[model samples]
Target chain A: DTAVSQTPKYLVTQMGNDKSIKCEQNLGHDTMYWYKQDSKKFLKIMFSYNNKELIINETVPNRFSPKSPDKAHLNLHINSLELGDSAVYFCASSQAFTGIGEAFFGQGTRLTVV
Target chain B: SQQGEEDPQALSIQEGENATMNCSYKTSINNLQWYRQNSGRGLVHLILIRSNEREKHSGRLRVTLDTSKKSSSLLITASRAADTASYFCATGGGTSGSRLTFGEGTQLTVNP
Candidate 1:
């Protein structure tokens, strides 16, 4: 079974559009995260949820929102997406709220905004 | 800001050679982890070393952590083409006790 899976591996949409990306993890993890990878290959943390509670909200634009329906799923929704949002989005899960818990990332969803 | 930043954004080496990548972090960390990402795939956990540990090795991969200096290094010995991917260093530690913060990955190309 795929431990973590994301939908629509490739997304292409015009600017000012709204899109949502779904992510699911069957590893029974309690913590989930969203990371953004820019053109420079820099992976930056966007949001994290622990047991469906929001934590670690980076300086991301308000247009971007991350939702965790349950412990095993975390989804990202972008409103009024802009050209600057064109990048790969990765969803990850960790065992629990530990200091050194390693995250299992999904095959990133590449979003291209025009 | 990124917690970890890797030097030499790209690396190319022949098979059976060794490749070393360095990462520097800004704040104190409880532990550092290494991950590899192949093309069209998610990142895979390679190894993790706590701050108190200086060096650790697993098969062909060696990881060294310097807590005082807030730096770490990943060394892949006798690499293979299969190791051709991007390597990232992630640090986990925050006042609120949060998840890991990954670095700008180092793209390594192992040529056979």
Candidate 2:
């Protein structure tokens, strides 16, 4: 069984379009996170949710929004996508808190905006 | 500003050789975590060493944390071709909300 799973592994869209990437965790974790990896392989934390509530939001533009329907699922929606928004988005889930806790990650969602 | 930055962005070594990646952080922290990412994959948690602890080992992976120097190092012994991946150091704790800040990363290639 996949501990963490993300749908739409590959997405190719045009500029100014909107899309959503779905993520789910079967580990019964309370916290989930959204991370973006750019072409240079730089990973940046975009958002994190704990118990279906927004816990952390990085300095990302408002175009990107993260929604967690429950502790098991967290989804990312990108609005008004631009060329620079093309990257791989990863969804992860952790048991809770930061005390030596390990995070399980999904495969990843590769978004390419032309 | 990136809270953490890793040294030697890339390294290539032969199989059975040891690979070491160093990471330095800018601020104080309660614990540090190490993650690995293969090509086109998400990050995988490897090992974590806390600020109070100096070193920890799991399998063939070893992690060390130095509070004075504000740095950490990850060592993989007897590396294999399958171990070729990018390693990242993420800092957490001592911050509100418990959000993690990840370092740039180190790409290691173990040629069989």
TM-score on alpha carbons, each prediction:
0.96, 0.96
Best by lDDT: 1
In model 1, the Cα lDDT at residue A78 comes to: 99
Give the residue spans of candidate 2 off by over 4 A.
A98-100
Clashing pairs in 2: none
Q: Write the per-residue lDDT of candidate 2 for residues B1-112, one digit (tens) a residue.
A: 5788998899999999999999999888878999999998888999878789999999999999998999999999999999999999998877523767789999999999
For DockQ, the strongest prediction is: 1
lDDT of 2 by residue, A8-101 (tens): 9999999999999999999988989998888888877888888998978889999998989889999999999999999999998888565527
State in Å the error of residue B96, model 1. 7.8
Clashing pairs in 1: none
